[model samples]
Target: MKIIAGVIIVISCSAMLKKDDVVRQAFDHAAKQTLVMLKEVAIKLQAAKAESKNPMPVAPRTLKDGDLVVVPSRDWTSGFFSGVLWYLYEYTGKKEWLDEAKKFTAAMEQEKWNGKTHDMGFKMYCSYGNGYRLTKDATYNDVLVQSAKTLSTRFRPITGVLRSWDHSRDKWSYPVIIDNMMNLELLFFATRSTGDSSFYKIAVSHAKTTMKNHYRADNSSYHVIEYDTLTGKVLKKNTHQGYAHESAWSRGQAWGLYGFTMCYRETKDKAFLEQAEKIAKYIFSHPHMPADLIPYWDYDAPGIPNEPRDVSAAAVIASGLYELSLYSPNAKDYRAKANTIVQNLSKNYASPVGGSKGFILLHSTGSKPANSEVDVPLSYADYYFLEALLRKDKLEKTSYKSIQ
Candidate 1:
């Protein structure tokens, strides 16, 4: 009996080692493929920049009718490509990636003062924020602080939330989309870097206000919530990119999940942590969630199985879950779900190596209702996918408690 027990233990250890190797191989393959694809993207972006009259190309957003759609630094998604480059630099420690990241990140520095839109965080933080985190460049520090100031300008003390859009005034007086939750990270970073409690206060206020108003009874988030700035009351709950006002927009839900998890990390507030867990429960327990964990563009979209899978949403959820697992009591379940998401994204959603015009993953829906960027590879999808992979690798190799 003793001999048999010893053999069982040995076999179990061997299987564990084999599983680790397989996970490592998956990460390695993803890294290699990403490097190859982004090189081609860099070459194409150069040509586009040379030909275009607009600002220099910051990143590739997606394919439009099989053509690469590169956008300028002003675009909200401009920072994601730079973030991806930074992630590659983090993973491989390659000088080439470092140089590329700096170049693209520099393009976004001027946006620190562009207060026309509320995407200052998406534009500056994802670029300069990552750059600063990696290299601690003093120049990036000023850029981030200025960016946070610009973002703060959108915040209304009455509303207790930052305004999301300046356009569509007739439709919404003070629109606060669920996506705005993501920009709070810039505020939190600013406070930490400068010891300015105002930035922290604003972030906390926004998170608290959003937590109070953005979620349904089931914890699913609305895509847009318009506020009466005068009274600080929610005027309407609407949907610009979702299927309906009442439907669960997959990407919106993902943004909330990631945003709250990050808020908890920065604030150590149990409310934010609990909100993150609730959002996670809503996402994973949805009856419509695909078996592989990728979700359709919207949970209540007319078509179910036939709807386009939003790989971007899956990437964001996976990344968020990895972080949430570190703080939640259900750490094991969260980690397992995150692992499954990464595995499925790597195995099923990844673009063919050397294909898809250098984008990493395919079949992302940016805004299906608007007939824009449907069933295509988005830059943000690739960024979050790389982030999730890195988080997984870090968690696996180090003790989670030590990381905290």
Candidate 2:
């Protein structure tokens, strides 16, 4: 009861926000409130780990190998966990948090990632990047190299993009997802870090494939597409995230925004920059976007209570916005919007590190196919929350006020 009261009070602080102001100040205040409850948050992670009798995927989901390692109760935990550690380390220059982050980094190596999953970018690279930056562990470098090798193996020459899904149907390779665009950043990073050009070439080709097919006339993206790998043609563009064939999913749009910005960062391609700006502009100006930083799972989705919001997507975009801000030649407004999302999420949506609750965001959607936790805490939600925090902390430290 007391905890609920505290949460309510903390949430009330969110109301201090106004439209024009960048949200860093409000977010910092909320984070300070969370620090008051940080010990409880750490304890929750331990308790959840110890009291666990039900094995992996918590209780709701079945035992899939991918879900066991490198997952929050939902997918996308690393982006949050590593993001938080990165944020803390950046702020305090502490060694303890850095040490704790090392374990997760090491644990990811055991997972079965041969680049068959779109999430490889979200999982291995995110944690490995943390490991490389934090401890400079030579082992981490080796693990990253292996994961890159595996990820590259998924590159379908016929499709000119990495394949995503391998299940139930003899591992069909035609379907490409919009989320794959975000994953290509790993290739660019791997190439630059390893002085290998193959990685860069693959990343560029993948981006081009997405640009040509996955998007609609309005610059919105489709969640999935069935491609003709042999002929390098798109067979069908379906709506895994949307309501119908052409409806746009807001989170997918956010992925497009963040992903294209990342594409531009790696390739310096003018096309990617323009596409990112288009997506960001649509997302920011759209009437359906909630007053809060979070967005509905689909833009045209009916406002039923069952509809899910993608806080993880928002976090991803915020991090991308920060990068876009840095990379954009004359794009001040995009940076400001990015800064705004970070500030707003930190101020309103993020849950403090209280009572062993590793989740940073309050609302996230996951695996609608399983009728899973609809509007609940998710691993990726937590990941993006942490990522947003890291971006905010870095911006603050650099004295780089967000451009308005």
Error of 2 at 149 (Å): 0.7
Residue 161 lDDT, candidate 2, scale 0-100: 87
Instruction: Report model 2's TM-score to 2 decimal places.
Output: 0.79
Model 2 off-target regions past 4 Å? 1-80, 112-115, 168-173, 304-307, 352-356, 367-370, 396-404
Candidate with top TM-score is 1
lDDT by residue for model 2 over 93-154, one digit each (tens)?
Answer: 66765665564455556542544465667776777766676667787777776667678888
- CA-lDDT, candidates in order: 0.88, 0.64
Tens digit per residue, CA lDDT, model 1, 218-284: 9999988999978999999999999999999999999999999999999999999999999999999
Error of 2 at 26 (Å): 8.2
Residue 332 lDDT, candidate 2, scale 0-100: 68
What's the C-alpha lDDT at position 106 in model 2?
Answer: 56
